[model samples]
Target: MRPLKRLVEQFLESEAKGGILLFVTALAAFVLSNSPWAQAYFDLRDVYLKLQVGDWVLKKTLLHFVNDFLMALFFLLVGLELKREILQGELKNPRQAGLAVAAALGGMVTPALIYTAFNYGGEGAAGWGVPMATDIAFALGVLSLLGKRVPLSLKVFLTALAIVDDLGAVLVIALFYTSQLNVTALLVAALVFGFALLLGALRVRSLTVYMLVGLVLWYYVLLSGVHATIAGVLLAFAIPIGRARPLPPHADGVAEDPELHEAQLELLEDAAREAQSPLHRLEHLLHPYVAYFIMPVFAFFNAGVALEGAQVGSIALGIFFGLLLGKPLGILLFSYLAVRLGIARLPSGVGWGAIAGVGLVAGVGFTMALFIAGLAFDAALLDEAKLGVLSASVTAAVLGSLLLWKTAAPRPS
Candidate 1:
């Protein structure tokens, strides 16, 4: 429980900053798009930037690099979190993960169905997956602002659900969003993957080896027409799980200290104190990168969507209802049905109100939704989709915050 509390604290702190950046960038994009400099703002995103140092040269639009390369790192961090949780956190146990899994599935499916219902068999049907994601940083950020009013169980539920939501979003992107595949590039990607797997099996401890191979994998995947971010997830699985356990020079199985006799207990304590286990060290090293760099950069890049002079019609209404209403209903109903059918149990200290509020929070799909929207449509409908996402996400964020804030009794210091 102590470890869980600490994790929550760390998650909240980082999420607060990341969420603010997301909101600010989004707002800036909207304002700039609507302002007199709208045409220039649009052009600037497409303006090519190039860097050359002798034979080494790199070129891409600012948006392309940010969306393609930087976002891959973001997905990498997400993959790490998912892996950690499945290995040692709340998701390790099937029973413990049941409620969250059910809720997340419910949240995702319901919004998608609602979206599909509105845009069925039309150009908008491709956008069904847009509302299926839950932005963890923003949702957690809103919860954090409410302080101790929200219960710890609610927070835990939201985190687990969001992780599941992320998994679903990734799958949707890979399966539904992809177009024609480049078989040659895919073959190369497979070869690179095999090398990564071999390194993992050999328990290689050097990150440099992984980094170089990961870059190759990313390039191959990018060309293969599969989203490059998928490479991040694949590479995360390949990271070697080894610990650095330093052994001291032993003298004929005797303790180095004259005062301490040759005792097994003494040796064990020394080993424990000196050895920084592989999992422990990797987690420590990855934590700061995930919390600070990967998440913030992703937010800064992906959160930007032009919001000025947007239509407020069926699209906006549909999105708003799907997130704020449909999400909670779908999540709660499916979860309830699952429990009633004897498939799962409600988490301890978690009630209807909490679950409902979490469902609403899960509706806040600002980041992932926009990314999927970009893939679902060409330039024509992109603006409308962006408008729908922005309005729905804003609505979900505010409603979820208010709902959870009301439920959380002030905890005494």
Candidate 2:
């Protein structure tokens, strides 16, 4: 429990920093794209990259590499977090998880319906999945800015809700976004994926083995017309987490004995690390990279939608309204119904206003929304969708943060 608590704190702090960095990168990219160097900015995204292994070759632009390859790591991190929550964190208990689970369902369905309502029978209709996501880092970053003014319960609720939302987004990508399939490639991917899962059941703790299997699974999935990124999630489940044990209150183990030798302290430190599950170790290892490097680079490439001559059409409007209005409406409505029907209850220190505020924050769908927009729309409609996501994300952040700040009850000093 002590280790888990530390991990949670680390996650929150890392996200705050990462969210700020993402803002800076996205702004810089946007400015470059719309400035005199617009051509160069777009060209950078189009820079072709290639890798070959004998008869097998993989080639994609810089944008595709970031989106396809780097983003697989992002999803891997997401999968790890999702697994932790389901196994032992907030989602472990159905009683405690009911409210967040219900709210996440509402968050997903309402936005998709709202987007579909506006773009029904239109070219943009396929992009309904764009608004049905929550950028947890950005949302949690806002809460971090507010400091102790907000209850800890609110943060927990938001985290749980966003994770459930992530799972929904994963499903959407796997089911709806796939294109024409190559049966042979899919069959191979499936068999490889099953073998990886079997490793976990066999209690194999070798990270190297799982990773080797994952690479093969990824290539086959990519060739099968299924998104390769989904392999990240599958790999996550395949990695075996060793037995769980709570670390000491002080990691050094020297805290309790000031006279201990330096060599003894070093041994204690090593023992502490060994006690952690592979999931925890891997998650900690990847957190810094995902937050500081991969995600910001992804933002630089994907968020740079040229604003000049960009027409705001049904796609933009649908995403905007779906994120702004539909997100809050669905969350609040479902949460209220759940509580009223005795299916769920509000957190100890939370109220209707906080719930509403959280629903708005969940509308900060910048990362996943942009990723889905790329999948659902081509060059012609992609810019418009990006515009909608950017505008809605900023609006939701400001509005949600202010509401949470104002409505929060004063806590004891």
Window of ten residues with lowest summed lDDT in model 1: 273-282
What CA root-mean-square deviation does each model show from the true structure? Answer: 5.2, 2.0
lDDT of 1 by residue, 234-283 (tens): 88778754455665655226655766665755776567544643334445
Residue 206 C-alpha lDDT in model 2: 67
Per-residue lDDT tens digits of candidate 2, residues 107-210? 99999999999999998989999999999888888888898878877888899999899999999999999999999999999999899889888877667787
TM-score of each: 0.85, 0.95
The global Cα lDDT (0 to 1) of model 1 is: 0.75
